[model samples]
Target: MKNSKFAWLLSLLLVVALFLAACGGKEEGTKTTTETDKETTPEEEEAAVVDEEQVLNLIMTAEIPTMDSALATDAVGFDLLNNVNEGLYRLNQENVAVPAIAEGEPKVSEDGLVYTFTLRDANWSDGSPVTANDFEFAWKRAMNPDTGSEYGPYMMSGVIKNATEISEGKVEYTELGVKAIDEKTLEVTLEKPIPYFLSLMSFGTFLPQKEEFVTSQGENYAKNSEAVLYNGPFSLTAWDGTGLSWKLVKNDQYWDKDTVKLTEINYDVVKETATRVNLYTNGEKDRTSLDGEYAMQYAADPELLKELETSVFYFKYNQERTGEKTPLANVNIREAISKAFNKQDLVDVVLANGSVPANYLVPKEFSFDENASDFRDVNGDMATFNVEEAQAAWEKGKAELGVTELSIEILGGDTDLSKKMDEYFKSQLETNLPGLTVTLKEVPFNVRLDLDTNQDYEIQVAGWGPDFQDPYTFMNLWLTGGGNNQMSYSNPEYDKLVNSANNELALDPAARWQAMADAEKMLIDQDFGIGPIYQRGLMFLQKPYVKGIVAHPFGGDYSYKWTYIEGKN
Candidate 1:
């Protein structure tokens, strides 16, 4: 009996030991599997961090309304379309016009009245061959009076043959200067020589559109990403009609795809400064613009960037709002309002950026004459602040307006900076001009533009950047019945000066400069057609890794074709 019990005990002990060894092996295998799942491969580790070289993130103050080249009137739309569409030429990193869809420089006639362009072998994003017919269709569509294109009539008038006539309903759209010689060749005849023709052709207004696609989309055209076709280095994506965010992805079909380093560009509309700053701090944004006190706060940041541009901001007093005959119609009231506010104080206190007080409409840097003198220097300051003079003018204007107490609404932008500046204007104008009551109306940028266009505001705080590199760019805005002249202010003498500058005096550079200078003086100093505020100073933050982005004075705001990110991973 004792031997039988000992045998059973030995067998039980051996079975228990075997079970323990099996369990140990299972645990070892389980630990190895878990570690394998947790560990990342080299490729996986690389993707865990942002690939800065392939992606760019940015913020804008407002949303782009439309990407259609013909209808785009704002800087945001122009900038967006400039990236997604290619013209005959494009502004390079140096902002010099360079061949884009064109094979090379256009063949020009001796008289400089005609240009012939040969299209390159290129395909749109839809894989359709880009031909000269596309250019012809797009140009005619822009010139067609029925298209209701504001820039087309303004840009081509007095430049392209019969363009002015077509715009004025005296001729057919087919009479416009642009024509397709063949599938590959484009011929353009000019009414006269335009010295800046090539640069003008590089603008968004000059980009080509496919006839069928544009017709098919019709009213829905350029409202979203799918509504438009792209022939540039990048193709727009993920843009819902009114969304705040969108993406620009690299176009593999682009002729210059090899040169495009950014695979994706992400843009978000962030109007609030605090939100923009927060995004930048969180590494969610690679760049953001700063204004007012934010400029001062970010001035100490190592990544801070400052760019003083040719754009100017001013106040436009509308004399044609529907409800009432405004006091702005009286010259004495306009003059009083123009001189009531201290521009230096506005720039120093409200702007706080590097922006300079603009006493004149045209900015100081560009518009040089044969003597190499700046136009602003020749005209000197057009408007200035003088409380005593303003009060005296206001008293005189009160009698002229037949109102002892004048209440006016100042229309302004909805941004925080815009509000601050508008408030400052109200305070100063009310304080300086006795018996004047000021009200404020702040709205979104697009709404403000519409209000300005309809002449539906009493006083508008407005801004304009150069569309081309000329003093005439600023001078032409206030021409009688001009497309961009939202204000009702008009002077026949001003019209005469601008016409002469663009016509007979065009060949005479010195005379043209003088004419523009005189016109500016008549518009601002003598007439007070608009109140000049400041030349904008942009303060922003750019990551050290970002490179090769170009900020142009004319055309679009930035050229990101060569932009790339580095050191992200």
Candidate 2:
């Protein structure tokens, strides 16, 4: 099994992906923006709740690192943005795109190149009206290159016209895909029509910002609770940039202020599972992630379990790190490592709860293939380990490369399960691959992601959940130009398949499914750069007191917003 070479095949696949993105006939049917995102007339002068007197409390397992939407890129970043800012559209509980700051679904021009937005007369937490240029400023700033924003591509590059060009220094920043029609309206031109456009807006990276606020505060903006603006239902009450915990209180100035009932939300950022579960049981915290062995006991107590099929826990090989990445350059050696572990057994023994062992490139629950069950035999994978097969591969690989007793380093989290998995991976590789030496290192969860983005480690553990419902979410990671594709795994045919799917857009459902399926198989069949661990299982629990919480597979994710607490204000 060999990895596909995407960097070489990108020219062809990029063209195909472009065609798929523009292939579908005009969609008069994209998700509509939420009420807050709608267009407003001057006569609608009702002042939104901008100065709330009441505060809410929220307890979370993580702490937010940055308040600046452009700079934030992880769970903490998203939590911060979802609470403090608003997008033109929001993902609903059903994971469908709905209006937020826009008046309605974007008005697509007959040519399919232009999109017009009617703005909602919403105000920022600072009492300034949110206008089209607020978005304009944000978009331009995102692509400015000098902003040091890691999330810019996640924002404009794929869907918006000229976005990729501007970000790549191929065009002027002013020429990027968006423009302000007036103070109340915005226009967007996509180089290609994208089915996933509206859904992409729901992400925190696309949240709006006020130009004056941004420039005035400079680096100080989003540095603390008082430095940021609020457009969502709540505002931070007791957080500085340094707090281990914070609070979210109702914002009286919010557009839908009347509907918000939870008066105060207390948040505590607990990274340790034992500490988190203990807080929940000791009544020190209202909500938390249950640790191993505790999940079963808590489940029998009658609380419903909530789960999301996020992709997998994975290790990425950074091929571009000069001295730290040569072994990763050898596909056979990489394949030997992939064949050396049985992650399913690890999950069964270590996870022992909601998390499942993943072996697929894309989560099974995500795709929509009619013949998809028949593509290239899903059961066939190089990752299926036999000690003999592993040894054979390792022996052949080492002989060809002329290496003896190699030293390899792997990084993961400090979790008890992670520690065991690290040990398991080490033992499997050392035993199966003769004369091989392995080293296991554990870091914090957030620190792992940080290292991943920096491509700082040789073999580092990581995972990615879908940003939207499209198969592109998984496939995009392999694209030569993709941000998450840090492994340097490349294949021309695989890239061609992904590009073909994008070109077709929302048309020819059968062909679309097949394209994504073909791409997944090609990548997985190669068995290097990535090892399939398990399809993620969604699992969580809520108090009976909470209601109306949106649990859409693709929605804006309403566990924090749409849920209502009975008898609480």
Best by the TM-score measure: 1
Model 1, 238-306: lDDT tens digits are 998788899999998888887788899999988888899889989999988787878888778777777
Global lDDT of each model? 0.76, 0.62
Q: Report the poorest 10 consecutive residues by lDDT, candidate 2.
A: 1-10
Error of 1 at 448 (Å): 1.3
Q: Quote the RMSD, in angstroms, for model 1.
A: 21.2
Q: Write the per-residue lDDT of candidate 2 for residues 1-569, one digit (tens) a residue.
A: 00000001111122222211100000011112333335444233122222322223335544566777777655555644665567888655444567889878888888776879898878887788998998888878877888877666554676678877876789987888789989988998887655445655666667788888889998798888988888887787678887788877777777877666566777876666677766666655555545356655565544435454444556676666644545767777777777777766666655555555655666554443455453224433436666676677778778877887688789887766577668888887788788888888798766776777666777876666545444565677777756677666778888787766766533666676677777776666564657777544433444434334444332122335654454222
Q: In candidate 2, which residue ranges exceed 4 Å CA deviation?
A: 1-59, 370-382, 415-417, 504-508, 552-558, 567-569
